[model samples]
Target: MKGKEILSAIKKDIDEHVGEKVLLKANSGRRKVMVREGILEKTYPNIFVIRVEGNDRTSRTISYSYSDILTQTVQLVFKNNNVAI
Candidate 1:
């Protein structure tokens, strides 16, 4: 697939999983990685959001563009099935 096609495919996959539990792994630079468990929230035309809760009972939303997934800068996996999207 071409770049636009691939991005669209990624967006479609995420759209199907909205409101589901997902595990997010992201590269935070300097050899550090950030991992979080969150519910897949909303998908805009350019980005998708995830709601992550902290140990202190706090929650925040993080959004990433579809290109991040295409470039492997971000990864998403379904919590229940352990399948990467």
Candidate 2:
């Protein structure tokens, strides 16, 4: 699926499971790594970001945490035809 689709899916999943635990996963990419890292950058204990990937293309997924964050669910806002923060 496209990045926007993936992000929307993630946002929905997060809202559906509030106050619970959730996991995010994606294929190998610099953007994926950045998202994982950003999620980990929590000042206080809240959410957790896990990286899950495989050596081969057939098995690879990067994950992001949504249940821990307190912000409202946001869609994958895009700018310049690319994923926007």
Candidate 3:
């Protein structure tokens, strides 16, 4: 999927699920998105594993590139799952 599409899908999933978790398999070099002040927390074309805990609490988001991914499965448990990424 394209970059915006991937990000949007992941964001929407997080919003709908509340305190649930989701994973996004994205292209490498995607982690430049979450960079901090002169520091890099992650590197990409990776799978972004995200967990939503509620009320602005720090969610754990890590990305792994496509090449690095061994296996992938996407499950939409609560409907509204047609959104692409």
Candidate 4:
């Protein structure tokens, strides 16, 4: 797939999985990575949101673009089957 096509495909995949539990892995730069468990919240034309709960019981949402997935800067795995979405 071309760049735009790939991004659109990623968006569609996430759209189909909205409201499901997901494990997120994000690269934070300098060889650091952040991992979190969250619910696939919403998807906009340009980005998708995930609702994550902190260890302290506070919940917050994070948003990432489909291009992030295309570039492997972020990854989403379905919690049910341990498969990357």
Where model 3 places Cα greater than 4 Å from the true spot, the runs are 20-85
Better of 1 and 4 by lDDT: 1
Best by TM-score: 1
Which scores greater on TM-score, model 1 or model 4? 1
TM-score of 2: 0.25
lDDT at position 45, candidate 4: 97
Lowest summed-lDDT stretch of 10 residues in model 2?
35-44
TM-score of 1: 0.94
RMSD of each: 1.2, 12.8, 11.8, 1.3
lDDT of each: 0.93, 0.33, 0.36, 0.91
Distance from true location, Cα of 15 in model 4, Å: 0.8
Ranking by lDDT: 1, 4, 3, 2
List residue ranges in candidate 1 displaced over 4 A. Answer: none
Model 3 lDDT, full chain set: 0.36
Per-residue CA lDDT of model 1 for 1-85, tens digit only, reads 5888889999998898888999999999999999999999899999999999999999999999999998899999998778897
Candidate 2 lDDT over 62-85, as tens digits, reads 333443222323222222233332
Tell me each candidate's TM-score.
0.94, 0.25, 0.24, 0.93
lDDT tens readout by residue for model 4, 15-37: 88888999999999999999999
